[model samples]
Target: MANIVIDRIRKSFGTFEALKEVSLTINDGEFVSLLGPSGCGKTTLLRIIAGLETSTSGDVLIGGKSVIGLPPKERGLAMVFQNYAVFPHMTVYENVAFGLRMQKADDARVKAQVEKAAGLLHIEQYLDRYPNKLSGGQRQRVAVARALAVEPKVLLMDEPLSNLDALLRLEMRAELKTVLQSAGTTTIYVTHDQTEAMGLSDRIAVMHNGVVEQVGTPVDVYNYPATRFVGGFIGNPPMNFIKVPVTNGQVAAGSEPLTAPEETGNEVILGLRGEAVQLAPLPLGLEMKVRVAEPMGSHLLLTGSIHDQPVRVVLPSSETVRSGDVIGLKLDPNRITWLSPESGKSFPAATA
Candidate 1:
């Protein structure tokens, strides 16, 4: 395992700055994910670490040694791309052993390591099958096995499960985590999928427009987002932002007044997760005219508008509200977030 450190890395493509003095540290044996939307520089940062893209400035260190001048092969790291990229003509065993062969390991040692990695990935039974004969998940496992066969200090994955179906993606996620944990390889995974990042990472670095927006554990970033962009980006159904007029420690949504703990001198945006909005029995509350109601197994997703602003609410499936229903929602101040109306900077309430 290796500790990866990126110190003030900057990269530009023509006039576009891909990475703007981005800095982060991945501890030895830690699984850290770089998460953001497309064109947000998460992939560029990964490629820089893999030596596939050169940084305009700054340093990349592996195990306390700078690898700025090293080639990808000499960097002592393995990378897996979005596609499986397994050779269709090669058997699973051959694909897994390719890296070891490139490094000129003895035939006996290569066989042992290949068998061990395949077993670890639970693909040992399919070792003799060619890629064309394997399932999508099996092919993905072969790709991972090939990377593991190198026995590198670190592993880099760039949206490795994107090509798989939802069920297969979830299955591979569990399998990949197990294999990586057993091997104890330091891993840096890049993805735009917030759920995947939250489920797989020890910590996530949320990026935006070539800069690091927030870097924290999933809970920290979710519960106490550093910016409105993160609050809006990292959640399922996403967080709802209502632009409200602030006055005397209270914010008003249309004609209804909602209580929050933020000072009222500045115009602030109110943020509430879909789950935090309570469908209450009160007569007068934040009024939302439901536009669509989707039953998602255990819960119902209500997409509607509050004074023409979009709002999503996740309620129990048993609640029998339908489209075009005007419902009163009780805002939970304890779970609410306040952000600068103009800057979108988040200000979380203090815990008692």
Candidate 2:
């Protein structure tokens, strides 16, 4: 296991700047995910770390040693590509043993290592089968076993689960976590899926436009976002933002007044997660004409406009509501997040 450090990394492609002074450290044996949407420079950053792409200017350190000039094979890292790059002609045993064989390991050593890795991935029974014979999930396990057979100091995965079906992906997420924990190897995963990052990583690096917006646990980034972009990007349905006016130290929105922190700006954005908005008794809340109501299994998602600004609320599916109906909603002031309109940054809650 090794600690990986990225120092002041910047990348530029012709007239386009792909990365902007990005830096972060992955502690030994920690599982970190680089998460963002497409065109967000996450894959570029991952490629740079793997020595597959050189940075415009930066230093990459593995285990406290600089590897700026080393080739990918010399970096002592194993990479699992998105497509599960296993040779079609090779049997599972041969594929798992490929790295060791390349290093000229004897037959006995190769066999032992291949068996160990295959057992770890629960594919020992199909060792003699070719890649063409394996299912998508099985092929994925083979790819992972191949990487693990080499005992890499750091494991790099580039959206390894993106190709799997939804249920298979969920199953593999749990399995991958267990595999990495048992191996105790440092791993960095890159993906645009928020659920994958939230469920799999010890820490998530939220990237946007080639820059890292925040680095923290999933709960930290989701509950207490560092920027408006982070707040809007990290959640499942995303957060509802409303620019409400402040009058006499109280924010005016909908049909209610929410007390603002002292010394707040004239206008602030009130961010509300879906769960924070709820149906209420008719006499004491904002009245909104429902524009859409989506049934999501256990919860109902209600989309409507309050004060001409869009708002969404998540309620229990048992509640009766539909489109074109006026529904009363109560906002939880305690769950509200205040944001600065000018800078698009969140303001810390007032000191009580």
Pick the TM-score winner: 2
RMSD for all candidates, in order, please: 2.3, 2.0
Candidate 1 overall Cα lDDT vs. reference? 0.88
Top candidate when judged by lDDT against the true structure: 2
Clashing residue pairs found in predicted model 2: none
lDDT of 1 at 237: 82
lDDT per residue, candidate 1, 1-352, as tens digits? 5899999999999999999999999999999999999999999999999999999999999999999979998899998888878988888899999989989999999999999888878899899888898888888888998999889899999999988999999988988888888888899999998999999999999999999999999988887788989999989888888887667877764346766555445466778889987786536567888999999889999999886889999998888888889988877767778777767887656454
- Which residue runs of candidate 2 sit more than 4 Å off their true CA positions? 253-257, 261-263, 349-352
Worst 10-residue lDDT window, candidate 2: 343-352
Report model 2's TM-score to 2 decimal places. 0.93
- Candidate 1 runs further than 4 Å off: 252-266
